[model samples]
Target: MAKAKNDSLFSLIKSLTQTEKRHFRLYVKRSGNTQDVKFIKLFDAMDGMKNYDDKEILKKVPSIKKIQLSNQKAHLYRQILSSLRQYHISQNIDIQLRENLDHAKVLYNKGFYKQALKMLDKTKVLARDTKHFTIALEVMEFEKQIESQYITRSIENRAEILTNEVLDTTDIIKSSHQLSNLTLNLYSLFLKKGYAKNPQEFEEVNTYFQSHLPKVNFDNLTFYEQLYYYQAHVWFNKIVQNFPNVYKHSLAWVKLFQSNPEMIIKQPVHYIKGYRNLLGSLFQLQYYSKFCEVLAEVEALSQDKKVIQNLNTEVLVFQFLYISKINKHFMEGSFDEGVEIIPELTAKLEKYQYKIDPERVLMMYYKIASLYFGSGNYRKAIFYLNQIIFYQDVKLREDIHCFARILNLIAHFEDGQDYHLEYQIKSTFQFIGKMNQQQAVQKEIINFLRITGKITPDQLRDEFIKLYNRLQPLSEDIYERRPFFYLDILSYLESKIKSIPVKLVVQEKFDGLK
Candidate 1:
């Protein structure tokens, strides 16, 4: 009789989803049928078996033969055994999940995420009807670990395959291994899902590629095959650029892709895809040196009469602007060293004929202006600042203010009639006032007027007070604190010019003349 009952209980466990299984256990408990004790112990023991080692786990599996169930609850006993046989599948066993989540209390104590994810992927299908969300949560935690290592693994695997001609056993071991491209596609999806358990993982992957991809050659592979390989390579490399550590990887991938013209011309699909990835990666990396070098490579290669004619214009123009602006910052004669290459970039952008977005172009222009300002090329700086102020649509609030401030300060030092600079300030103030943003612009305006010696000490203080009062209602968003640095300058300048014959004014000073 015990042998028959033991067989029956095992059969019942096979059929239920975790939630249904839990419910059935709860049902047996509530029934108060004293005979159900043996079945309860068996179910409890099996669930407990998940967290322990094989030896320990096997020890926990209850000897169903010993539990003596009351014959009156025979109906419930038969129901369980029948359900297990009909629904449970050994093939879908969640071996890793069982280890991590067998006992709820011990779930996080042994945090072996790598193994845990392997089991959870297999068991997740069973979660459809289960209330064991904790199991899923544990699975998600392990998933972060996997994503963190994914790019690193991809780079490592690609290098090993390309140079050492070795296959990664881990890649082969995954049940989904045959679908390698699909795995990369999954990485892309993982990014979209917005849950990176390891933000640092993205960096590791990038570093591996930046350090390794350039070291290999694809001359051995057919152009199409190389294209396909590099396409995926570039795609993964692009993902790494958003992080600071591996941003350099973006340039590395672009250089690798451009190294062989045959790899692209004979394999347009691969080269085109590689180009797209190159654009994305460079955008994220945002470093200037790599930008210039890779951009030079792009310009040099694009000029070859045999190269693809319709390469992405945004990338071409952006690269041109990137290089052009970068050169603008060098000392006057020193810039000629780099400017020699501008002709080709200009040619490419002109051929493309304004495919770049006006706003993005202006951003590049502003970045260039800053570079020029740092390099002390005041003329170039003024030129780019004018573009940022007059040409760009949808100006960023802070950027416009910063540009205005930089221009005004430069005009003060340069001693030239900066009519454009004066016009920009007036336009900025007009834009601010028309939008009911006068109070927002007041402090900056006060500082500007004070710096140019247009306001007296008492007048500047009263100006700040009026602006403060005007902004009192909307104090939540603005940092209402007066900038002390601004006040300090006002004091120093006030002391120097107190006795000078000058009229102090607080109005908009809309006219161009100071």
Candidate 2:
């Protein structure tokens, strides 16, 4: 396994954009801070290096000894974050609300209860408007604190009003948390093995979901309550392979945001994620035309200055823009055209690599590998599959690793490396055996490969037909259908049985969906 990286200050500095770096410099010099000199030197030195090298920093800056270097780096790290926090307050609503709360606390500490309450009142409005119920509840608590200790005389029946508001907001927060927690669990289940693998797992998921799902009046739910409700449904349906319900809930999730359009700027990441899931459901349902329309919407979102509010939002928008467009090509089976994007997406991924999470990077490699495989470029398919197969984090996504290895084996076979086939088959089988999740699809494929050498060349078509017949029944079995989704093994089999290109077989299916 690759050792975990731990260059906190260097990593943060490397993640900063040029504009952010410039803002940090301006923020530090705003008060003409004299003590900021050495940290600035440290920050500049670390930023200039391609990698974190503290000894080299000491060589470059004689003002710092080895013992103090750690402290200087730590100080610089904090200063960068503080500068970023100040810089992005205007761009991020949560940050702005938080700053307002901090200011209100300062005022309250100075015994200016009225001013603090006033600041919190404004903060409350924005928080509630943006569906930040948790923040709004905090503001309410602070308001109650002030009103309880001193009669502010701010409004009539202040205690009764605060009590009622606090109770109502508390209920809303509780409901939202229950729903969001369910969503988190469902999503974690999906990430673990992609989908429910068998009858037992499906039953367990269904029981867990139905038991944990909180009852709420759909019409009366707060924006966040409604959002989490829909999000939870999306994950549960997706895990159970119910694409139609996935489409239903994902569209509802996106529509909830659209109904609250002003919140889009306040919660760009949520907005972007809603649309991303919508596109995902459309792709799974093979709603190609609708998928294209949603893809265009997200592409436009990626460019919207108002919604691409900050670096985080910018990264998510770009990520989904590429994902939805890639899925668009995928639904169309336009593999060659899709491969055209590999170069540009590659460069952009490298640029935004630090900002992007590792799971997404691994997923991108799998998508790229699938594109190559669909394009009849098995060598390139294997190349990308190797990245996932040898990915350092095996525990991250066990199913994807297994599928990638299976695809790698098939790619080698398709590339006519029969001499390497037996070893590949054995190794892949062992890998699957070691895994906790399994599908009959994998077993059948491995079993077929193990017998391939024993079958005569002329009997290959018959063997392919037999294998297809076996997998076709499993296609109707929900627990056994995962490999169909991940590997598209059925289409490959159909292509082989019919002696046609895989893309053509897939495009024919796409045309029918249209």
Candidate 3:
């Protein structure tokens, strides 16, 4: 009896075919025994039932048939029963459909796009026949996205190939639109990597772009225009350094700027850049007169206070002052005639003094002294000269030497007795001597005294030659370049000391010439 029951159980398990499986699922669900068979559990059981062949169990018991009959109460149960009965007739069909769909998804994820498409082609045909429009549309979108990725990858590969080859600017010009996007990307890449491998190409990239850029429509450019404009300016600046001759057309730049202030101002700072270059070119050409003419026009156009303030803060103000000062110094003018302009200038300096850098402020002091000295306003010259000497660093020995001469002249000038020339002379010499013992600035005091009329030219010349001869080698070691300034004074003193009419005093360590 035990052996017979075991055989019966095994047979029943084998005979659970698709139809019997569906009947079993329905019976399990509604049989108040909602415990053993959930939907997934029953579905999995039906999946295995595709391979089951249990003829003996079907012949042995009517229990499975009884369960199937119990499931005929509702329309859904009837439909389920009928579908399962049909599934039993063709056991392997659902398994093949599921395997095919699973294979399609794996191919899609692995980027085997063609194979995935082939699988999807069959899937879509089946889905359409079954009227699954939503699922079909999803597959269509996935395919479209893949096609877009293919096009993007093709374009990227073409760009990489072009980068490896020689780039002809002429070809780029002809195919500007197609090449424009790729060229812009290449430019950014080259800039990032320091472009050491292709330095020359990188340098000329902007020149090519600038020449071609104007022809390229601004609105049509896909790049951020601001970056393009910055590139143009950077290129032009370098060009100006190498070939500033292009800036000879100051009038053209001025005219362009005048006609379209808004546009020129907005034009990437590159368009108006040639003006500064033009200023430099004018200086080099010694077109001082024309330089003055051009600069006046630029200054007039840039008269807005905000613009002037920006220029000053950028350190370009020093450049402006330099050009103006050079032009004023060389352009024809009476020494005293320029003195009347000082008060107006003093007000300007006061206005901008807080904004000025220390180096420029010292330059301003130097300029003021030069103007005063040229006009023979010795007191004012002495005042500004003192300011410069006090403020400047001691390492600037050349300027200090010149300042000493100025002090000597001021000490000798009419109404100049109030200032202490000797004290200043001693102080300057002491400071320089401490730093460099070989320097002989103190030995020149006799010539300064002659300039002040405290000694005759003959006395000064004798003293100076004596001091120079004794200190000449020492001066040479201290001063790397030329030694001795005041050539005119040196010449005159030489003449006086050697004159037949004058009897020079030569001091000796004796009561009389031994």
Candidate 4:
């Protein structure tokens, strides 16, 4: 029985395209279901529903008995899957390979050993070419079965050949798996700790990566194994804040796919991830020209129906496009341009809210807040930062959460909310302490903001200058620069002292970069 919270069937139905739904309806009708079919009626009712309510479904689809609703929903769900399978048989490589394997089995049962072996050979080639090792192994097993049962002239020394092939393929698959596991661990370390803020954290991640990294001959590795190797290196560099190495390895990862375009077609998800990491490295390096070139290529690939047909890939397309698009503005300090796209970006964020990860959603909120802050709209910035500060979830990205609170405090101060400035400072200080994020930059910001209200207006400029001088060196400190990466406190203070907008100060800095 489906639980009240488990509306997976309804969610799946809601995710279907109009073409898929129409195909499903035609599939049912072609199978001799009448116009008043129970499942069809239920499908129509559920399709039109704004939410999944079992009582509402039963009320609308009177043909379904109350006692049998669960069974009928389950049946419809399986039927939809069946229809999708048939529809995608020609388009999906895994499905086609499996279907071919099933046909080979039929031939074997009908005493056609030669035909079955031939089919297995062809299917094994497809599976191996696509790096579908498990299917390839299964096809090899089928071949071994036929070789034992009946030996044909073409099957001479076939057992020896199959034995060697299986051994080599298994070794490659194991190596790939190990590298992939290392990559995942490195990524987890990155997500939890975020760029190794301290020397100890850096040493920990570096030790783990170096110890677990497989010492394989890169020249002899298969494409998939090599891909994972480069990916592992990319994550290692990213975690240690080695942007140059990140660019080198991530560019290699992207080029591997570009050189093997067929793999891009077969593994669009990996291809998308490669581009994402590449763009991230390029953005960090501020290589705007190359970034724009790659961004355009990704946008073009995303529009190709063949590249983004799967639901997960569809959501990934949006994720990569929006993140890279907004990041371009961030890199150039084009806050006004970033603000212009917030409406569309927010709508897409809400539309794909379920499909996107919460971490990404939170990051977007931070980016939006930063955009507002850069444009001097401190109230709007605080509004978005509050979304992150008040997020009531256990799995929130702790780094973003901590930084959002810091940015919120700065925004309140910049907005001149003097009435509650002391209280905000106290709350932010306590929150940072609770999170155990009392680093040099965090402590300095808290100390400065905590006493802002006590200083008279005549002494405000001197205090701002004093705090700026104290923080300028810390902002340049290799280990203390992480918070400033998110919020440019020095520029804000300089703007306050110079009696100019922070935007102008940021623009002047950006021009110096050019």
Candidate 5:
């Protein structure tokens, strides 16, 4: 039996919204062969299935032979995609531009050169305005073809004009492509090795960014060129731990979309990304007011069904909304409030598990663990941290994995799972070694946790104070603050020393900030 999880057609049908399913059904019915088509029967069977089982499908639709099932599923998949294409082509800009280009081609082949040229002209402008440079280039090629074969004296200078336009557009596209490539490389570096934790690391990233950056005339750049220009700088600044520059470029990124609000609808993925970076920068800088304002805008946009119609956009909406909610609590020391949303958030995470990036989902787990820890539910915190520690996907995020192990140790220790504390300590050290993340802060925390069981209960408070004093400076150290960012070990120790709750310590720190 074929499992639903392994069936592409089954997954696709399951992914569709009710409206889309209705559209596909109506489309099949309009074809006039719905009752006799095996593919349609297969579609209905799969759609109704809670799980994909080939044996069950064969039982439900006896006409489909077992040997022919795969082919039928493939045909159904293609039909669904075709229906979806017809449904969404009008709503998508790139599809509209491609259709125009295709129409122009058909007209040209029919010897309607004048009509073809007219269509190309309109599409070229739309494509250029939307930064659909590849499509614009194709349109230009079509225009050139029409001009060569059906030229009139009125357009005698058209060739030269078109030549210059092509060259200019090509230059802009090349520049944008290069900037985008550089930005992606910088982002990959960030995922592999977070923000530079030391002066040497910062210098290395800065040098690489400076060397790879393309030279361009910034003033004459197109919307995409300008966006990529700012995006490249934003990632570079983020890597070098220059939060001020990160904010500046991130704000510029958001402003570009704001100035061209139409682009937000036309290129929503980029728009969401810009907002994400802007929100992240605000959170890092603790700009609570502006963060809240931008977060509200994000929430408002997410509520717009039209804006989030795309499955990818819907996933991003869930990500940004939930992450921002967690950050809001983190900023205000409101872990209890943060805890209230976990049930809903967990359900969404499971619902969108395949669509959302694993790294982001794991980050939520870390945040949830942090919330539990702050609220003094150490066992629950440990429960969440265990999810991160045992997660088999190593490519997600090394820093998260590294810190998760450290946090797991602290949670276990605080929850009085001291019998296995030594074992966990050794296991974490080995994991850190395997991950190649042997930072001073990680070592310090691991060492303290390792020795806690050996300390007499009478000296535990003194030992906590000693560990607290030693880690306090490291927690503040710019080079060693990365781990501290993930788990507030210092605050936890302060709570232990003062005989108060960790949440209170966090609240005091937040109050002191004001």
Candidate 6:
């Protein structure tokens, strides 16, 4: 029985496109019952629902009893999957390979050994062509089983050639296995402790990565093996704040596909992921020229039918494209102009709300709020910040939540809402205390904001300079640098001391980097 969660049948139905739903209707109707079939009625009820409500489903589909709902839902789930598989067999190589293998199995079972061997050979060639080594190995194993048991001897010394082929394939699979494991663990480390917070953390990550990294000859690796190798290096460098190595490896990852354009079509996700990492590394390095170069490619990808045809790829391309676009604004310090993207970003967020994760939504809100705040649009900034500040699941990205509160306090203070300022500052302090997010940076900002009201107008410039000087050293302190990435308070302080917009100060710095 299909378990009844909000996700089970309801999510699958919601995930279907109009075309898929239409195909499903025709698929189910072929049974001759049309919409009256039990599962078909259930699917229709679920599809029409805005939310998953099993009780409401019973009301709409009166023919289905509570006792049989689970079984019927399970049947519909399998039927939908089968229909999709049949619909997309041409696009999905794995499905095609597996179907061919199944045909070979039927031939083998019917005692047509020579025919089965011929089919297996063709399927193996297709699998290898697609870099589906695991499937190729399975085909080889089936071939071995038939040749050993049936004595077909279809080709001379076939056993020797077959053994060597399987051995070579296994070696390549092992390289992929090792490199993928390293990459996954490195990513997991980043998720647990973002960007090695201190020297000790950096050393720990470096040691762990070096210990696990396999020593493989780059010239000898298969494409997937090389891709994972570069990915692992990119993750390790990113976590340790080694932007130069990140740029190198992520570029290699991108070029790996550029040199093998066919792989780009087969592995669109990895291709886009390479570009994503490349853009990130370039952004961190403030390599504006390179970032723009890659951003153009990303724009092209957003329009490429081959890249965005699959639903998953479309979601990823949508996300990576917008993120790159927003970062371009950030790099130029054109936050006022950046706000122009808010409507489109907001609509896209709503479009993929269920498909996107909470962490992604939280970051988008933070980035939007940061843009508004930087542009001197305090009320709009606070509006977006409140999205992250009051996000129900604070535990999801606590750092974003913490930083959102800090920015909210600044936004309120800047907006001249002194009536609300004291309360918000108090709230922020308590929130930080609870989250244990206190660093020199946070403490300095809190104390400065707490006392800003008492400073006389003439003394404010000196105080701003004092705050900037005090916080400037912390930016070089690896442990204390984190808060800056979220808020860039030092730049804001410099803008205040100079009586200029934050964007000018940031743009000057960006120009220096170039």
Q: Which numbered prediction scores highest in TM-score against the true structure? A: 5
Give per-residue CA lDDT, model 1, range 1-514, as digits (tens): 2332344444344434576686576556566773546555545554454232323323554343323333312545675654443333332234334543443224324654444444545444344123223444454444444445544342335433332211222222221222335336635543442212134656555564455343234554432233334444544533432334234443343455567644344333334334434543443433345545555665555564344433342354345444444432231223333344445544754544334545445545555554444334667767666765565443343334343444444433343444454555566566645533344435454345435445565675555454444444433332221222111222223323443211121111112121
Top candidate (lDDT)? 6
Looking at model 2, residue 378 earns an lDDT score of: 94
lDDT, candidate 3, at 38: 34
Candidate 3 runs further than 4 Å off: 1-154, 158-288, 304-315, 322-331, 395-415, 430-514
Query: Which pairs of residues collide in model 6?
Result: none
Off by over 4 Å in 5: 146-154
Give the deviation of candidate 1 from the true structure as CA RMSD: 24.5
lDDT of candidate 6 over 1-514, digit per residue (tens): 1333346678788889898999988887787867568888898888888877778999999999999998999999999999999887877799999999999999999999999999999999999988899999999999999988988979999999999999999998888998999999998777645777667888899899999888899898888899999999999998888889999999999999999998888889999999999998888777899899999989988889887767788888888788888888888998988999899999988778767877878888888888998889999999999988878977676778888999999899889998999899999999888877787888998899889888888998998899999999999886788887788898899899989999999999888977
Q: For model 6, how big is the CA root-mean-square deviation? A: 3.0
Look at candidate 5 and give me any clashing residue pairs: 4-52
Each model's total of backbone clashes: 6, 0, 1, 0, 1, 0
By lDDT, the better pick of 1 and 3 is 3
For residues 182-266, write the lDDT of model 5, one tens digit per residue. 9999999999888787888888998998898888888888899899999999999887767788889988998998899888888
Q: Write the per-residue lDDT of candidate 4 for residues 22-98, one digit (tens) a residue.
A: 89988988878558778888999989988788889999988899998989889999999999999888777999999
Residue-level error in angstroms, candidate 2, position 286: 1.4
User: Using Cα atoms with residue i matched to residue i, what is each candidate's TM-score against the true structure?
Assistant: 0.31, 0.93, 0.36, 0.94, 0.95, 0.91
How displaced is residue 152 in candidate 4, in Å? 6.5
The TM-score between candidate 6 and the true structure equals: 0.91
lDDT, each prediction: 0.42, 0.86, 0.45, 0.86, 0.86, 0.88
| Candidate 2 lDDT over residue span 21-89, tens digit each | 999989888868756489888877888888667678998888988999989878888989999998787
lDDT of 1 at 26: 57
Model 3, CA-based lDDT: 0.45
Name the better of 1 and 3 by TM-score: 3
Question: Candidate 2, overall lDDT?
Answer: 0.86
